[model samples]
Target: IEGGLLASPPPHQYEFARLNLTYVITSKRKLAQLVYDHKVNGWDDPRIPTIVGLRRRGYTPEALQLFAERIGVTKSDSWIDYSTLEGCLREDLELKAHRGMAVLNPVKLVMTNWDEVMGVGHLEPCSQPALPHAPHGASSDAAPEGTEPPPARHFTIGKEVWIDREDFEEVPPKGYKRLFPGNKVRLKGGYVIECTGCTKDANGLITEVLATVVPDTKSGTPGSETVKVKAAITWVGVANGVNAEVRLYDRLFLDAQPDAGGKDFIESLNPNSLKVITAKVEPSLANALPGQNFQFERHGYFVADRVDHVQGRNPVFNLAVGLKDSWGK
Candidate 1:
């Protein structure tokens, strides 16, 4: 009312601006409560999207940049559909990650003809050198602008490895494609092996699977033959492989809108979100630095844990995500 008498800017002007921003639900106080209650850890918990967390979750640097670009620079509070995030993520993954074989739930493999076919401890170098392909350069194709090429992987591979225990079913399910009695599935990145038999303990739990590697189907070799099969299983060599604990982590909450419903956020916690197990990794992974990323072939993308992964004694990996679309539903 007294415009001419207002000699200086009002002190309360900045405070009014603060009030508008204060009502955002992603408020620092609310987020801090989630952390204090262990609904999540500190912001860098692998479950969150802070840069460090994303890095630990095996998110490539390029993927994050792409996500920001797709969302566009905006000041609106509208909900961006989750599919937008997945599309950008998958596009970056197609070329930035290499495949390595790992069995999350291991079932033993006993080569009956180990002495006859190849003497026990007669190690064969099972390796896939085709991965870690060089990025297409300035004049060539395949290079994306402002994105650094993925680092090379020098991991080893093998024969006579452990398959996931769930891959075998004595009584077949409707669409199962793995080791059942007298069934055949291709050992991924390795060979075609037929499950001739299995050994079980008194409790009816499978002790081991006896399978014979198909003689002429080593991938990429001249004489390779493609076997007609629905399932291809993953494995790791027993002789030269590295034994590590793999931690599979999924979405922390079952509900996409976790803080909704007026219920305690912890109530929406997914009990099966995390599972830790001693598993096998390729020998070359034994030298991985903390936070290095790799796609564990059929399993998921994983990163060496910053807190618990030991380079030699007992390596720990955190499963970043599976290779399919199963998020924010």
Candidate 2:
């Protein structure tokens, strides 16, 4: 727009409220039905395209900026792949987000030798660098100086720890490196443990995993290299881990071009788009603030709930994006 004798807009000017990157745009006529019919929680529902919706969904400004640069503005219509937008989010948060461990499907692992090796009710201190390392070929200037330990997330490990259920199997799958009877794996940043067996309920469900800790093999200490393990699994101590409400959000539409070809977009709505689960996270995450981002170690990137997350009380988070593109995989 130009301010002259008459203020006038430049050629081909239009209102650009939020950047549109090949996603379906809801018509203004149907906005009322969406709210009245309870199809969505509100206009700010994460599934929608409103400004408040995007912010609540943990879509960072940098990610959107990258998305715009990726699929530039064009006059001609084109069906862009939806995964392109998700790829931008993963790239942006990989270098910036804090690192933490969370167990979405938790199973208890009992260290049977805890009292014999350590104390009876001891909790061994364990720490990991909050921002472990940057992406390959990125600037190395952000690294800490020599012998100065990087910023650490302090937590503890004890007789009982939580592990993702997927990391263990009773019947060995061809070449699984994770926990099984007679298999050994490191409890990341902690100690090397050897799985003895597991206990099952009357319904044939595995209830508890039994493992013995290898003495004097904690990571980063002398004799820590005495045992060699192929896989190291991330875990949260039962003594210090906190319970959190984590909502796993996925794509709203199963079809890439749900609104195209005069198709009924409502029919393509993904039924399993959202899943809420109680998760066990390390103590460091207890202080995560609204709009803050973190890489949930093996899981993916997540953001603290903007509306529901309460500091040191009722913790909640929403899945922002996965660590990799899981499209059609």
Per-residue alpha-carbon lDDT of model 1 for 1-329, expressed as tens digits?
27676656644532211111111124466666767877666776776545666677677768778877876654444455444654566677655555567777787786566456555556554556324443542432234677654443334333467778888888889987788877878766566778878888999888898887675666666666657667777778777677888877776667666565475666777877667788887766776678777778776677888877788776888877667767654
Clashing pairs in 2: none
Error of 1 at 302 (Å): 1.3
* Candidate 2 TM-score to native: 0.89
Assess each prediction's global lDDT (C-alpha) against the native: 0.67, 0.84
Regions more than 4 Å wrong, model 2: 1-32, 134-150
True-vs-predicted CA distance for residue 119, candidate 1, Å: 2.9
TM-score of each: 0.78, 0.89
* Over 4 Å off, model 1: 1-25, 73-76, 81-83, 130-160, 226-231, 261-263, 327-329
The count of backbone overlaps in candidate 1 is 1
Q: What digit string (tens of lDDT, one per residue) describes model 2 on residues 14-106?
A: 543433334445555454556667766788777766668778878899998998898877665566666787888888888778899999999
TM-score of predicted structure 1? 0.78
